[model samples]
Target: MIGRYIWEISELRRSHHGLTLNELNERWERSSLYDGREIIRKTWYSHREQIASQLGIIIECDKRTNRYYIAYEDTIGRPDIQNWLLNSFAVGNMLMQGKDLKGRISYERIPSGYDYLTDIIEAMRENRIISISYQSYWKDEPSEFELMPYALKVFKQRWYLVGANVAFEGIRIYGLDRIKNIEITQQKFKMPKSFDVEELFEPYYGVSLVDGEVEKVRIKVYDNQAKYFRSLKLHESQEEIKTTPEYSIFEYHIKPTFEFEQELLSHGESVEVLEPAYLRERIKKRLEWSLEHYK
Candidate 1:
């Protein structure tokens, strides 16, 4: 019931711009989840506190307009994990209310590794180590190891754990789907003060880190394909260096890793690597290899 109210209050504030206590209550009274009793100011304040603490959403008042609104609206959208959490709850709440329309709604099924998320998150929070039996795609058998959990990332509807292997000296990314079994340990490890997950990943395109120098890379995206790159950037360093009626040239300071090359290849003929002659040659070779298969 409280979960439903949280979603309602959040949705109301997000869509309406802002609302006063009375304005909020008026809408709540008419809401589908509303009970016979009216929500007093005390209860409303309690709900506000719960929303902030549980969802990391802040409801602050605009003193000039005397209306309540969601704070850090721009910042909230920046973190993908936080956004996913809020969206999950909001969707669950909506699904509960619309039980009759069960078959009407469709969702993408994310593959395995969900079972390990809670344990991994707890381990990360407590700064403890985790034991995992992982099955790598290239390997024939599962291997057990202990990891100092650092951070979690979701990309392309898949979850990945970025952590340090206790027996090894460097950080590595593990796909959750590949984890056969996992257990959290009571033993704690201090996360490195110098380690910044964002900084670590800033130079790459995907979760897989490749060993290479970051180069000044440019790609020419043609026709309608330019709109997709414009709306959804290929990389954070992406900048429109040149524009024409037929195409647009986007530049980036990135490592042309295997994942990055695959991404560029996904665009096929629509994208052409302009600079970094080696990367261009690499892409050309891959395309030629692909062409041979078709022929």
Candidate 2:
């Protein structure tokens, strides 16, 4: 409820008029929120205001209208701030519910499974380069890589760090789970002011940015599989190319990396790569390889 309250206050600040208790209650009544607490009391409002103030969300009550208005600069734009508020709200809500979260929800994500998150984030925030000992599945042993931490992204329930590796003099992606140890460097580096993470990764699907040519990948999903693909888009660049009774063709303008192929193959025999001859052959070879294993 606190998260919702923070969100509500931030949103209400966009308007000239503030939100009154009656208006707020109307919203709460329509949704499952706090025990429907009457926040009209001065003390209740003051207490919440204090918490919001700490987060840089200034709140003021108008004497004439008897309503609450968000007065401070917006803190909602910052992901770090939002994350803190979300954690605070979730913990507060769980306490209010007086129930353990066992089976209540399945996060199914292990982003927090690693211990170096704080260290990496701190390095990124401070514009400090970091050295990490990483072991990749494809590699025989752990290797040391000095990376300028740029941004972190989550793909398929795993956390990945995207940055420039000073050691290799190239940009690379590292899986947090594979990270053995991280050392924050004393030498500071300048992150390009024009660096845009989204643009850097626009050509790739998922976290794997293969040092290969980008392609317009087309997949032909047969029958029921097409519906599932439509609901859960294969990629942001996914587009319906053509549909026929036998199959429906969808296209994604992306880097058809190993991860992308794995995702397609995971859908079993329902999907077929059609546009690129290489991807099609790759998939065929994989299926043949699977048969050989069984034989």
Candidate 3:
């Protein structure tokens, strides 16, 4: 019930320019989730506080207009934490309302790793170390190690942990799904003041890091595929360098990592690597190998 209220209030405030207390209550009463009574002033204030504290969203009232509006509308975090939380709850609310439509509405199932999220997040919050027995796809056996949990990221429906291996020199990323077991340690460590997760992963696509420099990569996306690229960029550094009726040339300053190569290959022949001879050659060789399988 509380989740529904939060989602309703957040959605209402987001859609409108501003709303007065009476105006908000009126809309709430009209909502399908509305109970018998209207939201009293005290309850509304409590909800506002909960929303701000729990979701990092603030509902502020305009002193002059006497209207309430959501502050920090456009400044959501890089990972879009606010939207992610709200959207997740919104989906839950929808599921509750439309339980009969379960078969009709499909969702991409996240394979594994969500079970470890809470523990990892707790470790990250306290700046504590985590010991995990991890199974790597490349290795035959599981390896145990202690890691200083720094951040968690999701890509392609899989959760990944970015942390420092206490016994190793550089930072490492481990897929949560690959973790066989995990435990939070009593020992704590200081998170480096200079460490920024976004900055660390900015030059690469996905969580996979490669032994290469950030190079200027350009790709020509042909026909309708260019529209998809424009709507949802492949990378933050992506920019449309040139455009014509037939195709659009997009540029990025990123490492041509293995994950990135796979993403380009997923687009099939719609995308062609135009710059960086090495990356183009690599892609060409990959396509040749793929073709050989068909032959």
For each candidate, what TM-score against the reference? Answer: 0.86, 0.71, 0.88
Candidate 1 matches the true fold with a TM-score of: 0.86
Q: Return whichever of 1 and 3 wins on TM-score.
A: 3
lDDT of 1 at 266: 99
What is the per-residue lDDT of model 2 for residues 1-295, given as tens digits with 9 covering 90 to 100?
3555554554354457887768766665654444656555675567566667555566677989988775545465455555555555555544444444456654444644358888987898899999889998999999986889998877775778989989677678888999999999998999999887777888877887677766888888998889898899878888988988888999998988788889999998899888699889999999999999998
Scored by TM-score, the top model is 3
Ranking by lDDT, best first?
Answer: 3, 1, 2
lDDT (Cα, tens digit) per residue for candidate 1, span 1-295: 5665565555654666688778777776866677767767797788878887666777788889888876655444356655666676677777666666778987678785899988998898799999999999999999999999998887777889999999999889999999999999988999998887778889998898888788999999999999999999988999998999999999999877788999999999999999899899999999999999998
Candidate 1 lDDT? 0.84
- Which candidate, 1 or 2, would have the higher TM-score against the true structure? 1
Comparison by lDDT, 1 against 3, better one? 3
Rank order (by TM-score, best first): 3, 1, 2
Superposition error at 187 for model 3 (Å): 0.7
